[model samples]
Target: MPEPLGDDLVLLFAALASTTQAEITAALADAGYGDLRPSDGYLVQHLQHGPVSIGDLAGKLGITAQGVSKTVIEMERKGYVSRTPAPEDQRTRLVDLTEKGWAAIYATRRARAHVNRELRAALGSGASAFLDQVRHLAENSGALAALSERRLRP
Candidate 1:
């Protein structure tokens, strides 16, 4: 039988994920976006290209339609996003980022870059290899595909 996955490996993955979020959170806070949660940043990033329907957002985020709706509501309250009737389909509402939302997105990008720089400095020579391994795992992992399949199911 193949060797079982080590608990340390799992913990390392979890720590990496949380640390990245924490770094982003700190960056946002420094940029006067302490009020925006990680989820809010994600939504803004998705809307950066243009407006999209709630269903489309749900699909892209691999989240439930209800979950996307709730996030949109919170974003609207914060003036980060706005909803308007789609001209092509009045029944559908399109969500777009506001000027504040664009600012948030820009800040997020800058914060992410800063975090990356910090990580590289901390990791020194090992940073590139570590990043490559992480990227490889993320791209080859079946977990995301399975999650998407489950979410798409009725």
Candidate 2:
């Protein structure tokens, strides 16, 4: 029979996945938005700062331009973002956040902060510090940083 996964590995993976999902769901709820997932927020954040092309947003999210275009269309329909003709290139359109998008992003940030605070409190000072150290170590790895940067640009 195959060996079971190690305790540390299981805990780490479960914690990472659950925390990400919980944080995302909480943020969306706090923003008074529904039907928007973390992937939506990821795209919204990039467009929130300013206008960007579909290709650029795709590159930032490490997805294909076609995929980004589809998501952008959905978001546009939801009134979170708008696509307008780029001044420099008539063929390409740039995506920009609407007021609703800005509000959502702001609320997400605030909700995430609250979640982090609650986590810290639950973990206690020492455990929280240790957990942060672990997170930093995991995040600071060269390959991980590269992957994250590729996925999250803005």
Best-fitting candidate, scored by lDDT: 1
Which stretches in model 2 have alpha-carbon errors above 4 Å?
1-6, 143-154
Q: What is candidate 2's CA lDDT for residue 80?
A: 86
Show model 1 residue runs off by greater than 4 Å.
1-7, 142-154
Q: Please, what are the lDDT tens digits per residue for candidate 1 over residues 1-154?
A: 6445565677767788799989899888888888898766556656767999999989877788899999899889988899999999999999998998889888988988888898899999999999888767756886556443433221
lDDT score of model 2? 0.78
What's the number of clashes in each of the models?
A: 0, 0
lDDT digits (tens) for residues 1-154 of candidate 2? 6446665665767787688668768668755787667778678767655899999988888889999999999989988899999998899999999888887777777777787677678788687677877678668766367545545432
- Candidate that scores best on TM-score: 2
